[model samples]
Target: MGIELELHSERPTWTESEVWHTSRATLLRGSYEHGEALEQLLTRLGRDSPGGLGSVDRVGDTLFDEREAEAALREIPGLLRQCVHESQTVAVHDLATLLASCAATPGSHLWFMGD
Candidate 1:
């Protein structure tokens, strides 16, 4: 049980036979350790209920559509500088990259699956 961030061409309904199938691009697969290390940053980003990085449930799921992704993309750089976890630096960078891709694509969405 961990956190997985995926980039999908469109909003996923999760009714697909294979959740991790070819419809999405796995951006980040973070273990409990990784999630713990980045908790501060995630919390600061905002809550998933408000279309931010922090998922509503620590073990549930959240989705960020193109607009939300763009909003996140704007804040990531400043938030990253405030991050103190060296181990999570790369993870955050990857997130920023994926967010950028999601923002650039018209109907793309970013999914945060946590468990």
Candidate 2:
């Protein structure tokens, strides 16, 4: 579960009531303290409760979307190229060369270079 925190930056300090309301809102919206929410969710699932099926998969899908993964994959080569171009010293060059060599080896390191 995730939360959308609306920080009241303009306020000098949050009142006790405001803090209580915010915490209540967060809990209502499925944000958990530590793994309590997940544990509760699993317990509910074992009992075949409707709450177990609510909002979990949607949140997970949004977090692990294909487009986001593709974008991260595309950025790696550009990052490596930038590192090589910005290497001004011998040590930096050596590090970049080592990285490039690792990147070239078949299945030696995880390279998600997508087409």
Candidate 3:
């Protein structure tokens, strides 16, 4: 459905300095129809950031990045995947929410549709 990126400063809590980017690609395979959604997500992430922590911006094609976004993205997917694989009754909303959170932060990108 959609992916989001969430950033944090220390080990746990996200501060105002953190960024939140998001990308929502098409549900159909191979169609990257959600570019505007991704752009808007990035813009929102930037707006949420505390001044001097750097900027949140969209990158070429399907990439979005922020200074602190990258680190969070690196580990979140694996955790999600693990949850998906390990749990039989995993909540769809929870999974989607996790995906969105993962996609919104830095270094997170969505492969929507066919991608």
Candidate 4:
């Protein structure tokens, strides 16, 4: 079945914005454990996989450097076009902005969590 999804960019975080957690999650369609598809896309692109980002144990250790995060965010639209398109409210641009904000601050990283 071709399920159609509408985007909603402003998704609430599972915890405080800057707080680090044991597992990484994102605000996608469902809730706290949403965004598997998005994660898959990242995996396919070699950015992140099922286990983690491949480069690091992103669960509790992932740290998004401002410069590096910016670079990675730039590639989101093109690299994960399907993910961007599926999100009816959460535009890729918006997500990038959120992630950028997290990256800009101290003790903050790009970890997704929502419920």
Candidate 5:
């Protein structure tokens, strides 16, 4: 099982299965084990943190609207700095880059899909 981060121009119209199979959205994937580490880090950061970083559901789905993406962008740098593992660093950076793109594109959303 793994997690996928997808960028959609608007709220996706496809069903979850269809989104996985057919959507041509920008995507980044990571192992579920890696996601667990990321989630632990987020937990340490506190769930109520302003950027909603702690709200990511690593075993389910989480969606970040453009405004939330903008807030997350502000927190990514700090998150990256706290990463001790190289894979964690890469994941955080990749997520940040994707979120930044989503934030800049009006109406875009970032989806964190886990399975």
Candidate 6:
């Protein structure tokens, strides 16, 4: 029983609220803390989501749409680099790799299924 974030469709097709309204996309699957952090990071970037990343309503909810996902994909690289300076964990490493893959894949939906 852990966090599970997976991009539903290969192409992010929405960017409404980070977690609230996906319309018909895959929701990011993760823990409350992950959503908290995502809210912080995304909010800093001026994204929508007044309520912040919501609790797991469904396993297949998509956090960001195409545009929002693109933005996140761009921002994560810097954060991933920062992980290098901090004390890293296996989880961190795995997440970094996964994010990198998502970043690399043009239409790749990154799902969090690390349980």
Highest lDDT, which number?
5
lDDT of 2: 0.27
TM-score of each: 0.70, 0.20, 0.23, 0.43, 0.77, 0.35
All candidates' lDDT scores?
Answer: 0.65, 0.27, 0.32, 0.41, 0.73, 0.42
- Model 2 spans with C-alpha error above 4 angstroms: 1-88, 110-115
Off by over 4 Å in 5: 21-40
Candidate 4 C-alpha lDDT tens digits along 2-110: 1111122232244556533413233223222224444444444444433233333323324344454555666655544556446523444455564556546544445
lDDT, candidate 3, 1-115, per-residue tens: 2332222212232234542221112111122233344333334333434431114334422232233333434433333343322231132223234344544544433222111
Give the better candidate number (3 or 6) by lDDT: 6
Q: Where in model 3 is the C-alpha error above 4 Å?
A: 1-31, 47-115
The segments of candidate 1 whose C-alpha lies over 4 angstroms from its true place after superposition are: 16-18, 21-36, 44-51
lDDT of 5: 0.73
**Candidate with the larger TM-score of 3 and 4:** 4
lDDT score of residue 73 within candidate 1:
73
| lDDT digits (tens) for residues 30-104 of candidate 5 | 233355556646656777777987787767888888999999888887898898888778778777877888888
Instruction: Tell me the TM-score of model 2.
Output: 0.20
lDDT (tens digit, per residue) of candidate 6 on 4-115: 4554446445565654456245443333334333333333333243322222223345443344444444444544443433322333444444455555556566543222
Q: For model 1, how does the per-residue alpha-carbon lDDT over 80-104 read when each residue is reduced to its tens digit?
A: 7977768668667777777888888
* Model 2 Cα shift for residue 50 (angstroms): 41
Task: Give candidate 5's error at residue 36 in angstroms.
Answer: 5.6
TM-score, prediction 1 = 0.70
